[model samples]
Target: MTFKANWEKADKQYFLSAEIIEEMVRRAYTPKKLSSWSVIAGGCANLNIKINFEGNKLPSILRVYLRDKKSAYHEQKLGTLLKGTIALPETNYIGDYKGYRFAITSFIPGIPLRDLLLSHETYDMDSILFKVGGLLAKIATCPISKDLVRIPANSNGNSGFIRMAVPV
Candidate 1:
């Protein structure tokens, strides 16, 4: 979808009324630079914005809350604390005024693994399978602990395979 259309879609989903948006811009925008702005890939929960200021690029991911203050605060706190400890995106900036809060983050590189696998033209008879296996093992062994965060009992952690344990 077009960028404006995508922003509108995100606004509707996140309950961002035009009045609210105008107010946010008025409060946040400055003549030389916008306090916050938009990025290329705008996500559902957060609208990513890249701002150019004084010849330095200050890119930020803007998270528009669908609800009131408390929900936004909780989301920001949890999200900020969880950064680096886990493999999630990093939050760089946070701002709240006029009942709307936004978050900014540094974008990461690398295409999705699913896309990579799907884009492969053919399955090689050589080391392709071995490389895939190694990648899977690396992902599986990534650091995780209950102390770090609670893993919901219902969550399958994005697994598509049948889960089974073979005792050694």
Candidate 2:
């Protein structure tokens, strides 16, 4: 399904007007001309909106947290601070908010990993297993932690988001 269509399906519940978008643009103080805008992806957590500017350039992504939380903004701030250390998308805009926060960043171009994997007709089962093993091992050894992140405290465990369970 197209990103725009999927986004509409998920975010049509909370409709946002063009004037609100224009206000958001103004609040962001972005120089890019917003010729068009649409939702790219959305979920119970966030609505990822994509904006097409006047330059025929690539679209940018805006993440609006569904719940009232500043974790998204914190994540962006931390990413900016650690840009050189880690490959993080550049944050271009941040919107004005009274309760919920909104932020914009350069769209990270790529298919969702799930879509990419599913789109493949076939794969070497052994190789895929080995790659998954290697990836997990690398992640296990990685030294990332909440300390490196300036995001809001996830004081509320689970926070109504889905959690994955994998058998070891």
Candidate 3:
């Protein structure tokens, strides 16, 4: 999704509120003391915040889905499947908060690939692409569980929402 479209479509209700943050922390079974919060920019499908809890050195990410629960469910399922295989943030919680679906996961450090590609002029693009290709290769080898629902096909071979590299 385009940055403008995603930003404009972002859910205003998902803005960081004391109550919501508290609830997210509680659901994640984290310490009550909140140290800091910062908006994490990049993703177009969700609003994210990196939250630091008191006495904990590592931060956690709160992702508020801008789409329907189905999108959240799809993400959660994919995360679960890729947990140990991929270097993904550990998912802590996924549930409805104030009528909006949200997920809390362990915070991962580093700039997003999109931002790096946009800002850097002389970076090693080949190396980065090779790494990403390796990661995708690993994901392709993973055995998908039978319980997980596959996305229905479309005329253009794209899923209803996100485009898939392989035919779903």
Candidate 4:
């Protein structure tokens, strides 16, 4: 099937049933009664559910890929790419379960940086950009693989991410 067709098909089947979540969990680890599963909002591209199973210490995030089936795999690769560059949720399980491409990842605590920054405190544009730049610097240095390394965007080029983080 084509990529566009696959994306549309996954979007139509967005709902992940409780039984299905349980089944996905079972494939990753020993199944336990799911204590709670709540949607984690504010994501731009995917469905994130903060789920807790009986006897688990920390919560796990169940992410359902909406745009593309390969999203889960790409994220798994990204986690590896950013392994030591910054703090990232460890992917516990990633698979295509019954046409639903998803991943169960270890929940990293704390609110998103966006929420933290946009709160009641008054932060000027430059301040936010500077702080965001620090984060970008870390990611900017992430290695794609042993043979290839990530190069910082030439501020002269059209990479907005580099420009936002570092004003030339």
Candidate 5:
């Protein structure tokens, strides 16, 4: 897949400096040297970078959460929980660097579904939809663990103070 550095123009605000990315790379468990990096250009709440390493066959994704520690922790927990059961990438590292919480995950190679649908005029919509449906069905069948609950005890009440619990 050809990676686009869209953050160089429209999404420049979400771009991370090479130094920061290098620091994140050093903090990771991988011994591979940094080759190249570019912003993934979709997320609004976090900065996602596609990182390539020298002598490594697959690239990794580095995500810096802009929301808060809670949001970062929630995502990390979800990634861990869904690791084996789902097709999602395995998170290799999750920690704070220069006050910003980050997570590095093994990159799953593919073009984003939205990008494919928008760019290709003759794309196979039926097959794509079927695959998506199957994936969703599999996800639905996965049991939710009780220990994963993060909602407040009183959040599900009719009281005005609490309305609904939103998952990160």
Candidate 6:
């Protein structure tokens, strides 16, 4: 019962009003109206929304940091550390709107990994899992300085956006 209540509250707290999304779109891209937007399923941590801009050159995702901004910083840092090493999208902007920390990232166009993994025998499961294990091991062994989690007052990374990262 308590878990249900807590989840219900999270549902409420994480909602994004159209006005807020409009502002996010304007700042991240041009001042164009949103063609459509939808909540991405699966994640239990942060909330990701897929938004369509009428004629955007590339699709984009809006990630709302739930739980805390520290997690947001961690994710952004991981994206930086793993770029080119993995298949994650590029982050365009990281900022706050009405107190919620958010990021705008280029959407990677592909089928979900889970679907691909389960859909066919064409994939080498063992090799894939081994590679994934190696990646996780690398992340686990990597030294995370206090700086990795420390929110810099005004820092930038390949940055098109200002620094408002939250400290871990």
- Top candidate when judged by TM-score against the true structure: 3
lDDT of 2 by residue, 16-83 (tens): 67777666765785575788888764354577778777976788776776655576767775565455
Query: What's the best-to-worst order under TM-score?
Result: 3, 5, 4, 6, 2, 1
Of the two candidates 4 and 6, the one with more favorable lDDT, higher being better, is 4
Clashing pairs in 4: none
TM-score against native, each model = 0.39, 0.60, 0.73, 0.68, 0.71, 0.64
Write one digit per residue (lDDT tens) for candidate 1, span 1-168: 112333333454344554554454445544444444444453544543444344545443345653444544565544444443335556554567565676544555555334445454664625765866765565454343322343333464653322232333
Residue 79 lDDT in candidate 4 = 72
Residue 90, candidate 1: how far off, in angstroms?
3.3
lDDT of 4 by residue, 73-167 (tens): 77776776566567889888887788777889999898776565546666585886797799788887553543333345576774433222222
- The candidate, 2 or 5, that scores higher on lDDT is 5
Clashing pairs in 2: none
Clashes of each: 6, 0, 0, 0, 0, 0
lDDT of each: 0.47, 0.61, 0.71, 0.70, 0.71, 0.69
- Model 3: weakest 10-residue lDDT segment is 158-167
Cα lDDT for residue 78, model 4?
Answer: 73
- Tens-digit lDDT track of model 3 for 102-147: 8888888998777766663778889988999999987886656545
Q: lDDT tens string, model 6, 80-148?
A: 755545668877888887888888888988765555564645877688779889877755654456455
lDDT of 3: 0.71
